[model samples]
Target: MKRFFLQILLCLAALMVLGGCQSKSEIVKLPRPVGTLAVAGFTNPMFNWELLAGYLPHEGQPVNKRVIRELDQKLVQTLGKHGVTAYARPAITRQCQEIEVFENMGSKREAAFSYWISVGECMAADYLLVPQVLFWQPHRGMKKPNYNVQPASVVIDLYLIDVNNKRIVRRIHFDETQQPLSENMLEAGKFFERGGKWVSAMELAEEALDNGLMELGL
Candidate 1:
């Protein structure tokens, strides 16, 4: 009986060792960075759409500032929920934009990792969260006199780079399309009402972030 118990313990120990040596893709919880993490290099190529009337900023308002502020705040909140110290520094983002090293790279992923390392060195950050807003567009479908159903589609790519290691620790890609509830006419009307809030896209993005973090076991 003692021999059998010893064999069982050995097998369990072997399994634990194998689990620790598993590939990154198979790993559940990722190792956290050394210290405080900062968000940098957040870019949204959708600035061209600011030409439209609705998206245009009013006097004294910076273009695209509102969206960036909301997104940045959400990221900070998400990291806080995970018990990670995080902050969004606009200066870091501006500096990243000015750097030419990441542009026209042979490997975009490698270039991004290098960029994060550089930023981390400048700020002494343990980790850098790089978020890219790939797509943010709205599609409308319906004829005149019929209620218009518009869907807001957004795609975001988030990369957590370990500054000390100069490598990407995790990458999360999220894509979603959110539309107002057409079945509820009153609610649908409220969505399109002038100056009324339209929260589908924001809600979906938050949900995606939550899901991504949970999947990463972070």
Candidate 2:
């Protein structure tokens, strides 16, 4: 009967939908390196405010130095749990100054690369781990869920450099901006995982840190 066929089609569609919902993307693991790693800590991007007027508000706020220090320590501790020896060097003002000199002469990327190499030599670390905070927008209201409030957003990049080889061992980039389930259906699982509550910038960054490290197999 036509009605029976319609019901069967609907059931098949429902099953297909459920299957899609349960599917998850696989995370590719990189080779784990041997030897100790020194965490270089987080750094803020240097942007020209005049040229990036519209983007200033989103990324202009200075991340607290204390927060940076805490993240560095957290990374070191996380590595320790994985049986990886690591140390944190949160104070990098002098290193930044040296990098600036290179920046004045050439591209910022090149300057950073050169600085990192020098840092590895100075620390005598077999490897160096650098974490950079690209953008951070904290929740406006109380660190709890408020339908009327904006959710936190953050972007972080982690790099593991093989000091002796002068090459990158692994890199992970995390960029997350919390949005309502209605806005991004793909993140429905994450929404429910967070209990449908908005989180703070710190919370988001911490999640990113953990996920990044895990993806690195650390």
Candidate with best lDDT:
2
| lDDT scores in order | 0.56, 0.65
In angstroms, how far off is 216's CA in candidate 1?
A: 4.7
**Relative to the unseen true structure, what is the Cα RMSD of model 2?**
6.9
lDDT of 2 by residue, 128-154 (tens): 777777677778865454468877888
Error of 1 at 154 (Å): 1.2
Tens digits of lDDT, candidate 1, 1-218: 99899757754554445433424355355555557666764566444331111121123333265666777778667767866554546455556546635434545545545555776666677767677666655445642223455665667777777778777777777776543433333333333331223445666567666656554444
* Backbone clashes in model 2, listed as residue pairs: none
Q: Clashing pairs in model 1?
A: none
Provide the TM-score for each candidate, comma-separated.
0.55, 0.72
Model 2 misses residue 64 by how many Å? 2.3
